[model samples]
Target: MKKFLGALALALALISPVAANPIIIPGDKNQRLIANNLYLTTDSLFAAYMSENLEQRRLAEMYVIGVIASSEGESWCGFKIASPDAVQEQVYIGLKSASEKLPKSRPAAAIKSRLKEILPCKK
Candidate 1:
């Protein structure tokens, strides 16, 4: 009986982290909603950046700065962007470089992956 109980406990412990969702930083319901919206906006801007209209592409770049600024006010996925300008620069660079590498990925997923590489929280 004790062996069975110990095995069950070990199994639950092993499964828990695998089942857990990535924690939305400093986690709160409101922050999760805001983060989700910001992620969506960033995705849209990425799509617009590919537009043939030069003006549309320029506007999309500008909008990415705004989205990054707003994201600073919400929860992040363990990124540690220091200032608004820094975030803007990082996002701009990510859009330019990372977008090319991930041609087949959804823009939001690609952006998120890029940002994670650029600005992970210090351990």
Candidate 2:
């Protein structure tokens, strides 16, 4: 058991990832890009999110920041909040609680974030 533990610890140390600066961007209930300048502010972003294609949404974010020429699959969607350090945690929560007007879309789905991956866009 001691040898196993030592090997596991060594493996973990060797595989550990280098951390980057943490950034959180506000997203709507649909987890789409609601920011006008950052994204087109279209239903497509929402639809892609509904389809669970979070990759697309992330791509859109990357486009906003010029990090990528265009949004492709699973790429980070670089959205800039109105100002630096302006983290609106409520925006996503409010959007989740609000009733939806879109037709036939399964009732309002809550937008949530997972900590491990930083897609920036969360739903």
Candidate 3:
């Protein structure tokens, strides 16, 4: 359908790959992976910013609940991040996801670490 094609085109145009299955510092056990590419329906880059902000905020939601919340909310931004050689291609990189899913005690901490690599280096 025309709609489908248009949608595909829009997606390719805006989103560019930044990181893919990126391993955070401290080795595989300690590090985490981030979904580089993001897709937005309307808000575009602003939407991505909002999602990242929320993911950063919910660092202490605690285990399961936190992961669920992050998964449902904009934190993941509707994208799935995959781990290295990960069976599940749909990866969850939210703070809670990072904490619960990663080896680290805090997913938020893991996310921040990933962001350090993601965020443009300060001059």
lDDT (tens digit, per residue) of candidate 1 on 32-69: 32443334333345555666656656756665555454
Q: Is candidate 2 or candidate 3 better by lDDT?
A: 3
User: Which of the two candidates, 1 or 3, achieves a greater lDDT against the reference?
Assistant: 1
**CA shift at 20, candidate 1, in angstroms?**
42
> Using alpha carbons, what is the TM-score of model 1?
0.39
- Clashing residue pairs in candidate 3 (N, C-alpha, C atoms within 3 angstroms): 81-91, 98-107, 99-107
- Expressed as tens digits, the lDDT of each residue in 11-75 for candidate 3 is 55435342211111122243332322212111122223224444422322223243434543233
For model 1, name the residue pairs that clash.
Answer: none
Instruction: Name the runs in model 3 displaced over 4 angstroms.
Output: 1-101
- Model 1: ten consecutive residues of lowest lDDT: 18-27
List per-prediction Cα lDDT, in the order shown: 0.49, 0.32, 0.32
Local error of candidate 3 at residue 93 (angstroms): 2.8
Q: Which candidate tops lDDT?
A: 1
Model 1 CA lDDT for position 107: 48
